[model samples]
Target: MAKGLLCSAMQMTWRWFSPDRTVTPRRQLRFPAYTPNAVSLALKSISKKTKCLPFGLRQPDRPLLLGGHSLDIVHCHQYLGVWFDSRLTFATHVHYIRERAATRIAALKALSHSNLGALYSVLQTFYSYAIHSIVDYRAVCLVEVLESLRLSLEVLQNTVLRVMLGAPPWMRLVNLRAESGFPSLQHRIWERTTAVIAQLCRHWPRFTVSVLLQRTLDRPPNPHPGGDWILLAADIVRKLDATNAICGGPDLPDPAYAPAPPWLPPLIRCVEPTTAVPRSSFPAVLCQDSLSHVAALSTPDAAVYYTDGSVSDDGSAGAAFVCDEWVESWRVTSSVSDYQTELVAILGTLRHADRHFYRCIIIHTDSLSSVCGLQTQRYTDNKYLTAIIAVAASITGQGGEVILHWLPGHVGIAGNERAEADARHAATFPVPTFQLHPSLSLLLRRVAYTVRHLSWEDHQFQIYEGSRSATWYAIETAYAPVTVPHGTSNYLLVSLRHLRLGFPCCGQMTNSNPEPCPHCFDISEQPLLHYVLDCPATSRLRCGISEQLHNRDEPFIWQQRLLHRHLPL
Candidate 1:
């Protein structure tokens, strides 16, 4: 499974390795006259001295000669537009990306301090569309490489948004990301990988499949053991196989051996053109915390059942059961999510505990939630949780005892890999009936999420429709739309709004009704416009405001319009 998963991941990586997209010096590498041109025209034309960058596994302190010219390799370099280090750890890459992104953010800060018209909006566009693309490019590969680097990328994005909103740097980042419509760095990476995987599964691109197949055909004994991607690729191949189950001899799969998930949502919505039907068993990618599963599985006389659940792009589900020598799988309905299916597979595995007579059986799952659910029983209110509890109750009636273990998916554990493969295979099975009965709480939460998203979008639309200033548009992109300017002016704007709505001014909201403008001690009602634009005490600031509009002699009507338009009170 590890071998296969590795091949699959390599395929994906290679597909993205488009030659045209690379920013390396490779285009000139193959040039016939490259060496002489570099010593002559290239060096003479350059203002700064040229440097050399090397990649790959072989490391040497000595420089390499290119047409008799020695090129020295330093510690870090950029390749294919992403940075790399001598160790290929991507640490340098992350640092380069961060520094470059920070420069843009600092530019934005400078722009804001300058108080240029519509500059905030410009910054917003730069961050939202352009900068994000720059930082997120090929992040799918880099994200899985290091957690710290992933967080760094996220922090960079947050810093950009925080600057635009004039928000405190110490603001809760999670809440801030959520409010600003930015998913966490990790989530964005996950989402992208998931989409790519789904596309790969759906299309089964010829080039990727052919290349991977050719590589696996060699299958040398004691092959180079790398990471879990090999196992993941193996699982994928097995699941896609039409006959000759990867593990179960050379015979075709047996339909009678298959089983379904113990529970599913009561209400299922059917979709047309479902996922591809399963041809063979499959498993999932390796997960984090795989070592625990490895350590626990080392016990003797304990049979490991790698069970997994999968949901396809169209929302169809499949559950797989992989015991020693036997592989069972079945397609399920939509309504149930990938996470729910994983938990449901665990429940099914638990119920099957009575069938297997092993003295100690290990039910291994890649789903973190399922493991947590079994331990905490937090999902008791949900139907799936109830189903899990019911199965768990019957466990005592069976053999010695079944231990539920959380095995990180895709790490290439034999049993776990088989289960994940089978589950994914089941997901592709074409089914006519799709039934689901979602628990009320589960249904409500999904609905609420959708509603909240729509409401936020609608609110944004209203703000856009009501205002024309680019600055407001940009700031509101990260914050709730507000007509008031940021800084101290926001306070004044909010207070003014309250006063207009029949609420007393800031000092004390007593029966004294509306208080006079405290700043100017005016006898007239403390209208915000008078205090902000026409008050004698504020005459100096008013002149500055007039100068901003390009002339101190501008009419009072212009000042009123500026306040009314921008302040919107």
Candidate 2:
């Protein structure tokens, strides 16, 4: 009678099964041969055989083994049917626990001390295994389970870090229980708690989750707290949101062009920031040459570096400068308002820097105009000049100084060759001139001269109009366009106009500039075909040009022929 009652109670409590390992109704009569231990063992096996239930196991609409459900193996005196998924794997473990409980009770009756340790180990193994087996469940429940496992393992805490030291190491109790540590064990636990909540908050932004994070953060680190990992996670999330907002969202006020600040890492624990050593171009820095001479000059007295510029009537200029550490003052000389001379002198000084104490010296320039422009005191009018100024500023900004001196010109001075070479080179460059209302004859002559001079093997010229210029088959890349913008065009044309001639415009090539007209040397109305085929005057000029040419009797072709006839000049 007692056996039958035990079976019935087990069936009512957990829907127990029998040999077939399935859920079914229990028998009314007690089996005379069966013991409670045998029945319990059968139940354990049956639980293990069951399949896990789906996620909807808690819903009444999805129950599988209850109600009128019955087993197919009823005749074998065993219960058998499809078991609920919840009872699949975990049910067997639970049954194992119950079986152990009975065994432990029996051992206690025999006064066995070893049984206590065995039971503890069994519980520890079960907890660890069960936690690992669970998947995609509630994080809150997982945290609670972890807390329970921690409390249960308190008595054997010393056994943890010992076995796990180098392999999947666990936190040592000694490390966590440190005295006067900024971050204690308690602090670490609390931070980890917040981290878990924050991670979950990413998927589920519930009010409860936020509250949990706040609570965890409010609590200080335990005895072994190190870095605020949770705060780092939170800050990362915030930055992500901020970045998204700045890209397009309405919440961000800044433009996408503005740079963002450096990210504060969550794991940094008061380590010093690192700085890179700057690379020096001087041979001493790279070759590790002895700096004994230079090093001695570094004292407060230092040296003076002088620079000078000059311009001559022969269309040349010169500059000279010297740096002397003994004097502590620069000796500089150069002409004022001269660009080429000053630039050449500057290059010369840079090349012969080893001749003086350039490392510890003050620079001096005679041209106040050039010095002021170089030193940002004056406005820069040319892009190339601006680039030079920028380079000088960068160099001087690094603890060097450049002083200006107004030296008088016309003195037969030294260092004039460099300035003369620069001026001569600048003058050697072909100046551009264009015709305003130019005659067709004069235009054709000029075009012929330009094409032959600019062309490499192929005789051609790039016509310029407004801000645009086109290169027509140059013999080499050495050829550069000779044109200026409308504003600068006036300057080049001034002398040509005085001589009653035309000059090319020196405008920058812009997308809006009109294409050049090949026939009339104008982009607005003279395309290449029109110049070669349509121009009446051009056609009259070249009656018998190349026979293979498409435009045989065309005025533009005639013009091209006439232009070519004067190529030698």
Expressed as tens digits, the lDDT of each residue in 1-569 for candidate 2 is 00011112134222223343332225332232145775666643232232222221232223233223321111111122212223122233333333434443343323322222223233335333442122112212222223344343232223322221111123223221211011222223333343344334333434564554444444543444333344433343332222111111111111211222246221101111112212343443422222231233345754434455444565333445454422111112222225534644554454344343344443333444554444433222333233344433443545444333322222322222233333334433344111012112222233334333323222121223221112211111113322223333222322221111111222222335656553455654324335444554455533565452453334333323444443211
Task: Give the count of colliding residue pairs in each prediction.
Answer: 35, 49
**Superposed Cα deviation of residue 293, candidate 2 (Å):** 27
Misplaced by over 4 Å in model 1 are 1-75, 110-123, 196-569
Write candidate 1's Cα lDDT for 79-163 as tens digits: 4676656445688777877877777777777755423423445556767665777755765456335667777777787777666
Per-candidate TM-score against the hidden true structure: 0.34, 0.18
- Model 1 earns a TM-score of 0.34
Best by TM-score, which number? 1
